[model samples]
Target: MQLEEIKETCPFCWSCIWLLVDPSFDQIYTEDCSVCCRPILVKTTISDNQITLTLAQEDDGF
Candidate 1:
């Protein structure tokens, strides 16, 4: 599978992290914040060789 490392700011800590993204499909997943150790919801969308990321507090409905 093709992978892309995307830099994103953690919503909880505002620290930067490199996220491994798959460009084959849209994805939603949870990951831990590296700096704050808080859960993060990552939403990814790929189009036209570009990746878009959206993050939120995990499962908090925020």
Candidate 2:
């Protein structure tokens, strides 16, 4: 299975953003925060044909 895409609001400030996943499921990409213009770190994993996504503070030192 693959993480096709992410359709969720930004947890930081509730801004709408699109999180697209690569085919390899090793990386996630998204636009900068609309409210803060700050980058967002997206963490994801795929297992059993399911995708789990997590959004964290870009500067949270992942």
Candidate 3:
């Protein structure tokens, strides 16, 4: 599916990073933090024609 680029803050490091998101529905993906070099759990959710994104800590290595 086609995706859109969005900017999100790294939950661990509070740094900015670009995210590719699926606009149709919620999605979970892993991406490493550019500033801290740690894995992040990137979550995207859409509701009421609005998109919400979040980042969290990931235990599994990527």
How far out, in Å, is residue 32 in model 1?
Answer: 0.8
> For each candidate, what is the lDDT?
0.87, 0.67, 0.82
Candidates 1 and 2 compared by lDDT, better number: 1
- Which whole-number lDDT from 0 to 100 does residue 58 have in model 2? 76
The C-alpha RMSD of each candidate to the native structure, in angstroms, is 1.5, 3.3, 3.3
Using lDDT, give the best candidate's number.
Answer: 1
Which lDDT tens digits does candidate 3 get at residues 1-62?
78888888887888888877889988788878878888898878899968898778897422
Q: What is the lDDT of residue 45 in candidate 3?
A: 83
Off by over 4 Å in 1: none
Candidate 2 lDDT (Cα, 0 to 1): 0.67
Per-candidate TM-scores read: 0.86, 0.64, 0.74
Error of 3 at 28 (Å): 1.9
Candidate with the larger TM-score of 1 and 2: 1
Query: Which of the two candidates, 1 or 3, achieves a greater lDDT against the reference?
Result: 1
Worst 10 residues of 3 by lDDT: 53-62
lDDT of each residue in 1-62, candidate 1, tens digit only: 97888899998889999888889888899988878899999988888978889999986643
Instruction: Give residue 59's lDDT in candidate 3 (0 to 100).
Output: 71
